[model samples]
Target: MSPTTTFQDLQAAFPHWTIWRSSADRLWATRNQRLTDAQLSHGLSHTIDADDADQLVAQLRNQEKLATGLLPQ
Candidate 1:
Protein backbone atom coordinates (compact mmCIF):
# COMPACT_ATOMS: atom_id res chain seq x y z
CA MET A 1 0.00 0.00 0.00
CA SER A 2 1.13 3.52 -0.76
CA PRO A 3 1.44 6.34 1.73
CA THR A 4 -1.59 8.41 2.54
CA THR A 5 -1.64 12.05 1.52
CA THR A 6 -2.93 14.44 4.12
CA PHE A 7 -5.74 16.81 3.24
CA GLN A 8 -3.41 19.67 4.07
CA ASP A 9 -0.83 18.54 1.54
CA LEU A 10 -3.39 18.25 -1.22
CA GLN A 11 -4.89 21.60 -0.28
CA ALA A 12 -1.49 23.24 -0.41
CA ALA A 13 -0.70 21.62 -3.76
CA PHE A 14 -4.10 22.48 -5.24
CA PRO A 15 -5.60 25.48 -3.54
CA HIS A 16 -7.80 26.19 -6.54
CA TRP A 17 -9.54 22.87 -6.21
CA THR A 18 -12.03 22.01 -3.49
CA ILE A 19 -10.42 19.78 -0.87
CA TRP A 20 -12.33 17.92 1.74
CA ARG A 21 -12.18 15.04 4.19
CA SER A 22 -15.14 12.76 4.19
CA SER A 23 -16.68 11.24 7.31
CA ALA A 24 -14.94 8.09 6.26
CA ASP A 25 -11.64 10.00 6.82
CA ARG A 26 -10.67 10.21 3.17
CA LEU A 27 -9.20 13.20 1.49
CA TRP A 28 -10.83 14.33 -1.73
CA ALA A 29 -10.20 16.85 -4.44
CA THR A 30 -12.93 18.13 -6.71
CA ARG A 31 -12.75 20.48 -9.64
CA ASN A 32 -16.31 21.18 -10.61
CA GLN A 33 -16.83 17.44 -10.93
CA ARG A 34 -14.41 17.18 -13.80
CA LEU A 35 -11.99 14.77 -12.16
CA THR A 36 -14.67 12.60 -10.60
CA ASP A 37 -14.24 9.62 -12.88
CA ALA A 38 -10.48 9.73 -12.92
CA GLN A 39 -10.28 10.25 -9.16
CA LEU A 40 -12.57 7.32 -8.49
CA SER A 41 -10.91 5.13 -11.07
CA HIS A 42 -7.56 5.81 -9.46
CA GLY A 43 -8.93 5.45 -5.93
CA LEU A 44 -8.09 9.02 -4.99
CA SER A 45 -11.44 9.54 -3.36
CA HIS A 46 -10.98 6.62 -1.03
CA THR A 47 -9.10 6.60 2.26
CA ILE A 48 -7.52 3.17 2.12
CA ASP A 49 -4.05 3.27 0.56
CA ALA A 50 -4.95 6.09 -1.77
CA ASP A 51 -2.31 7.37 -4.13
CA ASP A 52 -0.47 10.48 -3.02
CA ALA A 53 -2.67 13.47 -3.69
CA ASP A 54 0.19 15.46 -5.11
CA GLN A 55 1.05 12.64 -7.52
CA LEU A 56 -2.60 12.30 -8.44
CA VAL A 57 -2.82 16.01 -9.12
CA ALA A 58 0.32 15.80 -11.17
CA GLN A 59 -1.16 12.96 -13.17
CA LEU A 60 -4.26 14.99 -13.85
CA ARG A 61 -2.20 17.98 -14.91
CA ASN A 62 -0.13 15.80 -17.18
CA GLN A 63 -3.25 14.36 -18.72
CA GLU A 64 -4.51 17.86 -19.39
CA LYS A 65 -1.24 18.77 -20.99
CA LEU A 66 -1.34 15.70 -23.17
CA ALA A 67 -4.93 16.37 -24.17
CA THR A 68 -4.06 19.92 -25.13
CA GLY A 69 -0.84 18.90 -26.83
CA LEU A 70 1.14 20.96 -24.38
CA LEU A 71 3.08 17.85 -23.41
CA PRO A 72 3.74 14.61 -25.19
CA GLN A 73 2.25 11.45 -23.83
Candidate 2:
Protein backbone atom coordinates (compact mmCIF):
# COMPACT_ATOMS: atom_id res chain seq x y z
CA MET A 1 0.00 0.00 0.00
CA SER A 2 1.18 3.57 -0.62
CA PRO A 3 2.02 5.59 2.44
CA THR A 4 -0.13 8.61 3.01
CA THR A 5 0.11 11.82 5.02
CA THR A 6 -2.73 14.24 5.49
CA PHE A 7 -2.49 17.95 4.75
CA GLN A 8 -3.75 18.72 8.23
CA ASP A 9 -0.93 16.79 9.80
CA LEU A 10 1.73 18.61 7.83
CA GLN A 11 0.02 21.97 8.11
CA ALA A 12 -0.05 21.68 11.85
CA ALA A 13 3.57 20.64 11.92
CA PHE A 14 4.96 23.14 9.42
CA PRO A 15 2.63 25.86 8.31
CA HIS A 16 5.49 27.65 6.61
CA TRP A 17 5.83 25.17 3.81
CA THR A 18 3.34 23.73 1.34
CA ILE A 19 3.08 19.97 1.42
CA TRP A 20 1.44 17.41 -0.80
CA ARG A 21 1.75 14.04 -2.48
CA SER A 22 2.02 13.25 -6.15
CA SER A 23 -0.14 10.74 -8.02
CA ALA A 24 2.81 8.39 -8.04
CA ASP A 25 3.08 8.31 -4.23
CA ARG A 26 5.78 10.95 -4.03
CA LEU A 27 5.93 13.68 -1.40
CA TRP A 28 6.74 17.29 -2.27
CA ALA A 29 7.39 20.51 -0.35
CA THR A 30 7.71 24.14 -1.33
CA ARG A 31 8.16 27.55 0.25
CA ASN A 32 7.27 30.91 -1.29
CA GLN A 33 5.92 29.05 -4.34
CA ARG A 34 9.36 27.54 -4.90
CA LEU A 35 10.90 24.22 -4.06
CA THR A 36 13.31 24.10 -1.13
CA ASP A 37 16.98 23.42 -1.69
CA ALA A 38 16.57 20.13 0.07
CA GLN A 39 13.73 19.21 -2.22
CA LEU A 40 15.79 20.17 -5.22
CA SER A 41 18.84 18.28 -3.99
CA HIS A 42 16.78 15.24 -3.17
CA GLY A 43 14.71 15.70 -6.31
CA LEU A 44 11.22 17.09 -6.59
CA SER A 45 9.73 13.71 -5.71
CA HIS A 46 10.21 11.30 -2.85
CA THR A 47 9.04 7.78 -2.21
CA ILE A 48 6.38 7.60 0.47
CA ASP A 49 8.58 6.17 3.18
CA ALA A 50 8.57 6.95 6.88
CA ASP A 51 12.23 7.93 6.84
CA ASP A 52 11.71 10.33 3.96
CA ALA A 53 8.71 11.86 5.69
CA ASP A 54 10.66 12.33 8.88
CA GLN A 55 13.51 13.95 7.03
CA LEU A 56 11.14 16.26 5.22
CA VAL A 57 9.58 17.30 8.50
CA ALA A 58 12.99 17.98 9.94
CA GLN A 59 14.03 20.05 6.95
CA LEU A 60 10.82 22.05 7.07
CA ARG A 61 11.22 22.74 10.75
CA ASN A 62 14.75 23.88 10.22
CA GLN A 63 13.64 26.12 7.41
CA GLU A 64 11.01 27.64 9.67
CA LYS A 65 13.50 28.15 12.44
CA LEU A 66 16.02 29.70 10.12
CA ALA A 67 13.44 32.05 8.71
CA THR A 68 12.36 33.20 12.16
CA GLY A 69 15.96 33.32 13.40
CA LEU A 70 15.19 30.65 15.91
CA LEU A 71 18.36 28.89 14.89
CA PRO A 72 21.74 30.56 14.46
CA GLN A 73 23.29 30.61 11.03
Candidate 3:
Protein backbone atom coordinates (compact mmCIF):
# COMPACT_ATOMS: atom_id res chain seq x y z
CA MET A 1 0.00 0.00 0.00
CA SER A 2 1.00 3.57 -0.51
CA PRO A 3 2.14 5.81 2.35
CA THR A 4 -1.00 7.90 2.07
CA THR A 5 -3.13 4.82 2.56
CA THR A 6 -1.04 3.81 5.55
CA PHE A 7 -1.39 7.28 7.00
CA GLN A 8 -5.17 7.10 6.55
CA ASP A 9 -5.16 3.80 8.37
CA LEU A 10 -3.18 5.35 11.18
CA GLN A 11 -5.65 8.21 11.34
CA ALA A 12 -8.52 5.73 11.58
CA ALA A 13 -6.71 3.77 14.26
CA PHE A 14 -6.03 6.92 16.23
CA PRO A 15 -9.32 8.72 16.18
CA HIS A 16 -8.35 11.07 18.97
CA TRP A 17 -5.67 12.56 16.77
CA THR A 18 -5.84 14.39 13.50
CA ILE A 19 -3.05 13.05 11.21
CA TRP A 20 -1.85 14.71 8.05
CA ARG A 21 1.16 15.54 5.92
CA SER A 22 2.51 19.02 5.58
CA SER A 23 3.30 20.74 2.30
CA ALA A 24 6.94 19.95 3.03
CA ASP A 25 5.96 16.24 3.39
CA ARG A 26 6.42 16.09 7.12
CA LEU A 27 4.00 13.91 9.06
CA TRP A 28 2.06 15.50 11.88
CA ALA A 29 -0.58 14.48 14.40
CA THR A 30 -2.49 16.80 16.68
CA ARG A 31 -4.51 15.68 19.65
CA ASN A 32 -8.21 16.36 19.61
CA GLN A 33 -8.26 17.29 23.27
CA ARG A 34 -6.29 20.03 24.90
CA LEU A 35 -3.56 19.09 27.32
CA THR A 36 -3.73 20.24 30.92
CA ASP A 37 -0.76 21.70 32.79
CA ALA A 38 -0.18 18.41 34.55
CA GLN A 39 -0.18 16.53 31.30
CA LEU A 40 2.23 19.03 29.92
CA SER A 41 4.43 18.51 32.93
CA HIS A 42 4.31 14.83 32.11
CA GLY A 43 5.82 15.61 28.69
CA LEU A 44 2.61 15.33 26.76
CA SER A 45 1.80 17.77 24.02
CA HIS A 46 -1.05 18.76 21.74
CA THR A 47 0.97 18.09 18.62
CA ILE A 48 3.62 15.73 17.24
CA ASP A 49 5.61 15.72 14.04
CA ALA A 50 7.99 13.35 12.27
CA ASP A 51 9.91 12.94 9.10
CA ASP A 52 7.92 9.88 8.01
CA ALA A 53 5.00 7.62 8.77
CA ASP A 54 6.92 5.08 10.84
CA GLN A 55 8.41 7.76 13.03
CA LEU A 56 5.03 9.40 13.38
CA VAL A 57 3.48 6.11 14.46
CA ALA A 58 6.23 5.59 16.98
CA GLN A 59 5.69 9.02 18.44
CA LEU A 60 1.93 8.43 18.57
CA ARG A 61 2.48 5.15 20.38
CA ASN A 62 4.78 6.89 22.83
CA GLN A 63 2.11 9.49 23.40
CA GLU A 64 -0.32 6.69 24.12
CA LYS A 65 2.10 5.27 26.64
CA LEU A 66 2.44 8.62 28.31
CA ALA A 67 -1.32 9.05 28.38
CA THR A 68 -1.84 5.61 29.93
CA GLY A 69 0.98 5.97 32.45
CA LEU A 70 2.91 3.12 30.89
CA LEU A 71 5.96 5.28 30.39
CA PRO A 72 7.67 7.77 32.63
CA GLN A 73 7.19 11.33 31.52
Candidate 4:
Protein backbone atom coordinates (compact mmCIF):
# COMPACT_ATOMS: atom_id res chain seq x y z
CA MET A 1 0.00 0.00 0.00
CA SER A 2 1.03 3.60 -0.47
CA PRO A 3 2.44 5.22 2.62
CA THR A 4 1.03 8.61 1.76
CA THR A 5 -2.55 9.65 1.47
CA THR A 6 -3.77 10.01 -2.10
CA PHE A 7 -4.26 13.45 -3.60
CA GLN A 8 -7.99 12.91 -3.93
CA ASP A 9 -8.26 11.88 -0.27
CA LEU A 10 -6.44 14.96 0.94
CA GLN A 11 -8.54 17.21 -1.26
CA ALA A 12 -11.70 15.63 0.05
CA ALA A 13 -10.58 15.97 3.64
CA PHE A 14 -9.56 19.61 3.26
CA PRO A 15 -12.00 21.31 0.97
CA HIS A 16 -10.77 24.72 2.09
CA TRP A 17 -7.30 23.98 0.72
CA THR A 18 -6.04 22.90 -2.64
CA ILE A 19 -3.69 19.91 -2.39
CA TRP A 20 -1.14 18.61 -4.83
CA ARG A 21 2.14 16.84 -5.22
CA SER A 22 5.21 18.40 -6.73
CA SER A 23 7.44 16.99 -9.43
CA ALA A 24 10.02 16.48 -6.72
CA ASP A 25 7.48 14.40 -4.77
CA ARG A 26 6.78 16.98 -2.07
CA LEU A 27 3.27 17.42 -0.83
CA TRP A 28 1.87 20.96 -1.07
CA ALA A 29 -1.28 22.73 0.04
CA THR A 30 -2.61 26.22 -0.44
CA ARG A 31 -5.63 27.93 1.02
CA ASN A 32 -8.55 28.61 -1.28
CA GLN A 33 -8.80 32.18 0.03
CA ARG A 34 -6.28 34.70 1.22
CA LEU A 35 -5.60 34.91 4.90
CA THR A 36 -6.46 38.03 6.87
CA ASP A 37 -3.79 40.34 8.27
CA ALA A 38 -4.37 38.94 11.72
CA GLN A 39 -3.78 35.45 10.40
CA LEU A 40 -0.65 36.56 8.67
CA SER A 41 0.55 38.18 11.86
CA HIS A 42 -0.09 34.85 13.54
CA GLY A 43 2.29 33.24 11.00
CA LEU A 44 -0.33 31.68 8.78
CA SER A 45 0.51 31.42 5.11
CA HIS A 46 -1.42 30.90 1.90
CA THR A 47 0.75 27.92 1.03
CA ILE A 48 2.47 25.06 2.83
CA ASP A 49 4.65 22.16 1.74
CA ALA A 50 5.78 18.91 3.33
CA ASP A 51 7.87 15.86 2.65
CA ASP A 52 4.77 13.70 2.67
CA ALA A 53 1.01 13.80 2.85
CA ASP A 54 0.96 13.01 6.59
CA GLN A 55 3.28 15.89 7.37
CA LEU A 56 1.25 18.15 5.14
CA VAL A 57 -1.88 17.18 7.01
CA ALA A 58 -0.24 17.99 10.34
CA GLN A 59 0.83 21.37 9.04
CA LEU A 60 -2.64 22.05 7.69
CA ARG A 61 -4.14 21.21 11.06
CA ASN A 62 -1.76 23.64 12.72
CA GLN A 63 -2.71 26.29 10.18
CA GLU A 64 -6.35 25.72 11.04
CA LYS A 65 -5.58 26.21 14.73
CA LEU A 66 -3.67 29.38 14.01
CA ALA A 67 -6.38 30.72 11.74
CA THR A 68 -9.07 30.05 14.35
CA GLY A 69 -7.08 31.38 17.32
CA LEU A 70 -6.95 27.97 18.90
CA LEU A 71 -3.20 28.24 19.19
CA PRO A 72 -1.11 31.20 20.32
CA GLN A 73 0.33 33.25 17.52
Candidate 5:
Protein backbone atom coordinates (compact mmCIF):
# COMPACT_ATOMS: atom_id res chain seq x y z
CA MET A 1 0.00 0.00 0.00
CA SER A 2 1.05 3.62 -0.48
CA PRO A 3 2.42 5.53 2.51
CA THR A 4 -0.56 7.92 2.35
CA THR A 5 -2.97 5.01 2.28
CA THR A 6 -1.25 3.38 5.24
CA PHE A 7 -1.30 6.65 7.15
CA GLN A 8 -4.99 7.12 6.50
CA ASP A 9 -5.71 3.56 7.55
CA LEU A 10 -3.86 4.12 10.77
CA GLN A 11 -5.70 7.37 11.40
CA ALA A 12 -8.98 5.45 11.16
CA ALA A 13 -7.88 2.43 13.16
CA PHE A 14 -6.06 4.16 15.97
CA PRO A 15 -9.16 5.47 17.71
CA HIS A 16 -10.90 2.13 17.42
CA TRP A 17 -7.91 0.35 18.90
CA THR A 18 -7.75 2.88 21.69
CA ILE A 19 -11.45 2.29 22.47
CA TRP A 20 -11.04 -1.49 22.38
CA ARG A 21 -8.01 -1.42 24.64
CA SER A 22 -9.72 0.92 27.07
CA SER A 23 -12.80 -1.29 27.31
CA ALA A 24 -10.61 -4.32 27.84
CA ASP A 25 -8.71 -2.55 30.56
CA ARG A 26 -11.93 -1.55 32.30
CA LEU A 27 -13.31 -5.09 32.02
CA TRP A 28 -10.13 -6.48 33.47
CA ALA A 29 -10.35 -4.01 36.31
CA THR A 30 -13.96 -4.94 37.10
CA ARG A 31 -13.15 -8.66 37.06
CA ASN A 32 -10.06 -8.16 39.20
CA GLN A 33 -11.62 -5.96 41.89
CA ARG A 34 -12.33 -8.75 44.34
CA LEU A 35 -8.95 -10.33 43.84
CA THR A 36 -7.34 -6.92 44.15
CA ASP A 37 -9.23 -6.19 47.34
CA ALA A 38 -8.21 -9.52 48.81
CA GLN A 39 -4.63 -8.93 47.84
CA LEU A 40 -4.70 -5.46 49.35
CA SER A 41 -6.24 -6.80 52.52
CA HIS A 42 -3.62 -9.54 52.73
CA GLY A 43 -0.87 -7.03 52.22
CA LEU A 44 -2.31 -4.66 54.76
CA SER A 45 -2.33 -7.44 57.33
CA HIS A 46 1.43 -7.07 57.58
CA THR A 47 0.87 -3.39 58.39
CA ILE A 48 -1.06 -3.90 61.64
CA ASP A 49 -2.22 -0.48 62.81
CA ALA A 50 -4.86 2.18 62.07
CA ASP A 51 -2.22 4.57 60.76
CA ASP A 52 -0.80 1.87 58.58
CA ALA A 53 -4.22 0.95 57.22
CA ASP A 54 -4.95 4.58 56.42
CA GLN A 55 -1.60 5.00 54.72
CA LEU A 56 -2.09 1.82 52.73
CA VAL A 57 -5.57 2.83 51.62
CA ALA A 58 -4.45 6.30 50.70
CA GLN A 59 -1.50 5.06 48.71
CA LEU A 60 -3.63 2.50 46.91
CA ARG A 61 -6.27 5.07 46.06
CA ASN A 62 -3.65 7.44 44.69
CA GLN A 63 -2.11 4.67 42.63
CA GLU A 64 -5.50 3.64 41.26
CA LYS A 65 -6.33 7.19 40.33
CA LEU A 66 -3.01 7.58 38.61
CA ALA A 67 -3.53 4.35 36.73
CA THR A 68 -7.00 5.29 35.58
CA GLY A 69 -5.85 8.73 34.53
CA LEU A 70 -3.16 7.17 32.40
CA LEU A 71 -5.72 5.18 30.37
CA PRO A 72 -6.74 6.48 26.96
CA GLN A 73 -9.39 9.16 27.04
Candidate 6:
Protein backbone atom coordinates (compact mmCIF):
# COMPACT_ATOMS: atom_id res chain seq x y z
CA MET A 1 0.00 0.00 0.00
CA SER A 2 1.07 3.55 -0.56
CA PRO A 3 2.35 5.07 2.61
CA THR A 4 0.12 7.65 4.19
CA THR A 5 0.88 10.84 2.28
CA THR A 6 1.31 14.24 3.85
CA PHE A 7 1.95 17.55 2.15
CA GLN A 8 5.57 17.21 3.12
CA ASP A 9 5.73 13.81 1.50
CA LEU A 10 4.25 15.12 -1.68
CA GLN A 11 6.68 18.03 -1.62
CA ALA A 12 9.47 15.56 -1.35
CA ALA A 13 8.07 13.23 -3.96
CA PHE A 14 7.63 15.78 -6.69
CA PRO A 15 10.60 18.02 -6.59
CA HIS A 16 9.73 19.10 -10.05
CA TRP A 17 6.00 19.42 -9.68
CA THR A 18 4.65 22.78 -8.58
CA ILE A 19 3.01 21.77 -5.34
CA TRP A 20 0.78 24.11 -3.48
CA ARG A 21 0.09 23.41 0.14
CA SER A 22 -3.59 23.02 -0.41
CA SER A 23 -4.11 22.01 3.16
CA ALA A 24 -1.93 20.81 5.95
CA ASP A 25 -3.06 17.36 4.97
CA ARG A 26 -3.07 17.62 1.19
CA LEU A 27 -0.94 18.88 -1.72
CA TRP A 28 -2.05 20.77 -4.74
CA ALA A 29 -0.43 19.87 -8.07
CA THR A 30 0.16 22.61 -10.55
CA ARG A 31 2.26 23.02 -13.68
CA ASN A 32 2.66 26.08 -15.75
CA GLN A 33 -0.35 25.82 -18.06
CA ARG A 34 1.88 26.22 -21.07
CA LEU A 35 4.23 23.45 -20.13
CA THR A 36 4.24 20.41 -22.33
CA ASP A 37 4.41 16.86 -21.11
CA ALA A 38 8.16 16.69 -21.42
CA GLN A 39 8.61 20.02 -19.73
CA LEU A 40 6.28 19.09 -16.94
CA SER A 41 8.10 15.83 -16.47
CA HIS A 42 11.42 17.61 -16.28
CA GLY A 43 10.11 20.13 -13.81
CA LEU A 44 8.41 17.56 -11.63
CA SER A 45 11.75 16.02 -10.81
CA HIS A 46 12.96 19.14 -8.99
CA THR A 47 10.16 19.76 -6.41
CA ILE A 48 8.65 23.09 -5.47
CA ASP A 49 10.80 26.11 -6.18
CA ALA A 50 11.97 28.25 -3.32
CA ASP A 51 9.32 30.93 -3.71
CA ASP A 52 6.52 28.41 -4.03
CA ALA A 53 7.78 26.39 -1.14
CA ASP A 54 7.97 29.48 0.98
CA GLN A 55 4.47 30.44 -0.05
CA LEU A 56 3.20 27.05 0.91
CA VAL A 57 4.95 27.30 4.23
CA ALA A 58 3.45 30.70 4.77
CA GLN A 59 0.00 29.39 4.03
CA LEU A 60 0.47 26.66 6.54
CA ARG A 61 1.73 29.20 9.05
CA ASN A 62 -1.30 31.36 8.54
CA GLN A 63 -3.55 28.42 9.15
CA GLU A 64 -1.62 27.71 12.29
CA LYS A 65 -2.09 31.31 13.37
CA LEU A 66 -5.81 30.88 13.04
CA ALA A 67 -5.73 28.84 16.23
CA THR A 68 -9.26 27.73 15.66
CA GLY A 69 -7.96 26.01 12.52
CA LEU A 70 -5.45 23.20 12.61
CA LEU A 71 -5.65 21.41 9.32
CA PRO A 72 -3.90 22.55 6.10
CA GLN A 73 -5.66 24.53 3.38
**lDDT of every model, 2 decimals:** 0.48, 0.54, 0.82, 0.80, 0.31, 0.42
**Poorly placed runs, candidate 1 (over 4 Å):** 1-6, 32-73
Cα deviation at 63, candidate 5, in Å, is 0.3
TM-score list, all predictions:
0.36, 0.49, 0.84, 0.82, 0.26, 0.29
Counting clashing residue pairs in each candidate, in order, gives 0, 0, 0, 0, 0, 11
Q: What tens digits encode model 3's per-residue C-alpha lDDT throughout 1-73? A: 2546586698887888998889988988999888888888998879999987778888988889889962233
Candidate 2 lDDT tens digits, 1-73: 1257566788677565567766766566765345456655643322222235766676675555445532223
At residue 27, give the lDDT of candidate 3: 83
Weakest ten-residue segment in model 4 by summed lDDT: 64-73
Which residue pairs in candidate 5 collide?
none
Residue-level error in angstroms, candidate 2, position 65: 3.0
Off by over 4 Å in 2: 1-5, 33-51, 70-73
In model 5, which regions exceed 4 Å deviation? Answer: 1-51, 69-73
Task: Provide the global lDDT of candidate 2 against the true structure.
Answer: 0.54
lDDT of candidate model 6 versus the reference: 0.42
For model 6, residues 1-73, the per-residue Cα lDDT tens digits are: 1356455665575343356544454444543234445544443222333334445555434323442332222
Better of 1 and 5 by TM-score: 1
Tens digits of lDDT, candidate 1, 1-73: 1366566666576554566656765445554334346445544332222245555666555534433532122
Task: Give candidate 3 regions above 4 Å deviation.
Answer: 1-5, 69-73
In model 1, what are the clashing residue pairs, if there are any?
A: none
RMSD of each: 7.6, 6.9, 3.8, 3.8, 16.5, 13.7
In terms of lDDT, model 1 sits at: 0.48
lDDT of 5 by residue, 1-73 (tens): 2334332443253322211113222210121123245445444221211123234334434434544533343
Predicted candidate 6, C-alpha RMSD: 13.7
